[model samples]
Target chain A: MTTQQEFTDYQIDALKELANIGMGRAGAKLSQVFEHRVTLNVPNVAMVDEDKFNSLALKFETGSPIVNIIQQSFIGEIEGRSAFIIGGHNFADLVNILGYEEYDAIDEGHQKEMLMDISNAVNSACLSGLAEQLELDIELTNPSIAAFNTPNSALKDFFFKQKHQETHQTLLFEIKFFIKDINLYCDNIISLKISSLENLRNALERLL
Target chain B: MVNEEQFTEFSKLLQELSSIGFIILDRRMNVIFWNRFMELHSHIKSEEILSRKLTSFFPDVNEAWLNKKIRSTLVLNNQAVTSWEHRPYLLKLPSTQYSIDDVDFMYQNCSYFPVKDSDNSTIAVGIAIYDVTEIAVSQKLLENVTEQALDLQEISTHDHLTGLFNRKFFLDQLVQDASRCRRLNWGLGIAMIDADHFKSINDTYGHQTGDDVLKELAERLQATLRTFDSLCRYGGEEFALILPNTTEQQTRQVCERLRECVDKAPIISAGREIPVTVSIGISFLSRNKSLEEIISEADAALYLAKHNGRNRVEQHQAE
Candidate 1:
């Protein structure tokens, strides 16, 4: 029986591998649509305690730091929260590559539709792979997005609360993928309570 | 552990769990089972719909089409799906609630799955109906908005009189092309063209004839240019062309060709053939020059062309 602390490492590695496959597939699909060669990098995985999560996120900052976030809840034998963060620099490059004429005023409704499209593609690719690998049937909720020039204030507060809570464990993974001239950077964090560790271990064990 | 009462309870729970209107039909299209969803969506209750042929109650079910789909699904043992794109059939189910003014409801998606028996023979068909009227209506609204936006953009960027890029879009392109030329180390050229004595033409002939002459000139210019060249209505009785990656000599040659083409064709307007000519000024982008400076140089060349002789091309030589 794997303990909660040990299961964090296993989940990090498993998520990294799953993200690699999913990103590779998404990159291939994007390249076909854009008619350009694409490259995707295997993600860096980390298990961060709540105390270190806030400071750790602050270390990675550049330019305007446009962040696209998607949150989903998975419920089966082992339930957890899944979040994806995409950098704004990558989004600007994508808009240019897709040949959208730069407008003086960006339509909010159009921007929301575009966010939904990108979130749907990336989230579905990554989460479906994770589900298949874990041998679990997971239901996906409608995706919601939050953006900020700086690190998300709510996420920072969430990390602070996690540190105060009895369970101070979270798995964070960062992945960088490129399509032609555009580079896409994503961060995924899977957070779960210690009580769910046994079910998570069983889910991972069935995969092997 | 399998009891008849327990099976009945499980069946009741399964029916209640479904959001879609579920109706089980026999081979003759007689309703066998009508769940609560169907009862709520369609005013017909289980007692009224059961043991009655669908056409006898609804009178809209095309027997030929329904029987064909049922026979196909039974033969293949596969589920048959109907989407709104094909609009297989419209289900007019009455609203159970009397508070709602509209009694009839529109169901967009329907599926028929063949129910088989132990002997592998088709016993019944399960029909699943989904209400997608809201989705269909919303999609149409979105399409309408997109189309209106595209139309408005097109109107804003184009000249209404002569179907060419207006002055605003032309200037925007000039700025972009100038910057691209500077970055790529390529030459960019602009030509300022004006109809010679256009006021005199309108004075001699009517303004209507002068308008015809302008329209005719626009057609000739469009026909004489290459695909890479863009011609815009710079202003009244004047037009501009932006040529990317063109040398100064090539620019002069193109302007001369356009001038000659215009001179040879006499514009026919109001049953009178009127002769017209244009003076063109050409200038090339320089490393030390701004877009405004280059345009001013072309304007000076145009002044020189008008001062000397009309119906000719003049190259801007920095004084």
Candidate 2:
């Protein structure tokens, strides 16, 4: 029987390569939209349990008290969720980047729309990148805001609160994006189900 | 070749007949189609706008950002939307004839999607603009009404001259605070403050100057009290202060400080300095006592301060 660590190491390198290709395209799209230089760090792909999902967030420390997270679930060839998190402190900077500062008050619906747009871009680019590489047809839903103005404690339980069908390991892809010109920072996390992991591996092997 | 002209004629009819703003742009961001609604509101004819970049005329439009929205639709085949809240007007169009007052520009909700060809390849991006002026006007009206209601509430509850709680509101708060303190088993402090010789001040100086002195005295008393303390105008140059969770000693000390605050400083009105002083009477709350009993206790102390001499702090004598 192959241990989890062995499987993780074996898949991490390939997944990293796929992530670079995927996030590179996402970054390009973001750069074009923001009219700023957006740089994405090398994505870290690892297999983690549900408990580890909360632990992983501890590695990132933001000065802001509240973390604004945009979450979207995708169900298709694979089932999983994607989240885009930004510090509350940087929300003003984001508004300026989107050229939405002219409005006196931005309504809740409008704020959700703006965040959903960003989520859609990243989720679509990342999911499609993995789908194309594995040659799997995936159906992505319209991006919806799962949580906003989340505290540290609530954000920790975000993953556990999702609808549980069966226990499956998650292939967690973590990437950081920086807009150097505006000093804006955002993190994108994509988690895939472990059962789907086997299907993805088999699909990649057939392509090989 | 024949289908091209037919498509053009169909588009022309759609543009002219539709009330919504419709415009189609190619990959290069060049205008491919501009509907009659756009022409009427923007006052830019199709002849002049054709083949021209939309952002060229509307310099405020974020061309690069808008292109990204178009690209997302083109690449992912998803619809992109912008509301009036996010971006009020993509194109600054004239307001509707029946728009609410103070609304000069049209409010718009815009949608962008990819226009596909026969091969299912996206050739151009289509933008549909909906005039949401009535919804926007109604929202503004609601906000204004809410603000006006809050303003009216403030005017009703506060003394206009001193900006402190009026007699009716002060009495209500006193009754509520006294009952709460009894239930919680905490001491409540009550102090009655009156400006010494205020009638004479108004008689010597004009009423305008008298109003200024009252305002200044209210400011001084507010500064001397803690954040949790409540001060109110108790009618005719007299004020009531309620301090919760305070002992008799603390109440006396607070009243002393308030008396000193008014006595040491002279209020300047109309560029002339006038001497001013106040007498403060302090009382502590007792269980099972009514609000009037507590107030009458403080009122007796205030009377003692006036009798002994003005500009002093006095505690209620034990019966």
RMSD for each model, in Å, please? 19.9, 16.3
Worst 10 residues of 1 chain A by lDDT: A96-105
Q: Give the local distance difference test score of model 2.
A: 0.78
A202: Cα error in model 2, Å: 7.4
lDDT by residue for model 2 (A5-87), tens: 44545566876886687667766766766667878755577877766776776765344567777877777777777778776
lDDT of 1 at B17: 49
Backbone clash tally for model 1?
Answer: 0
Computed on C-alpha atoms, the DockQ of candidate 2 is: 0.11
- Chain B, per-candidate TM-score: 0.52, 0.52
Clashing pairs in 1: none
Docking class of 2: incorrect
lDDT of 1 at A124: 46
Q: What digit string (tens of lDDT, one per residue) describes model 1 on residues A8-68?
A: 5556577567657755765565454344565544446555675568775564332233565
Error of 1 at A80 (Å): 1.9
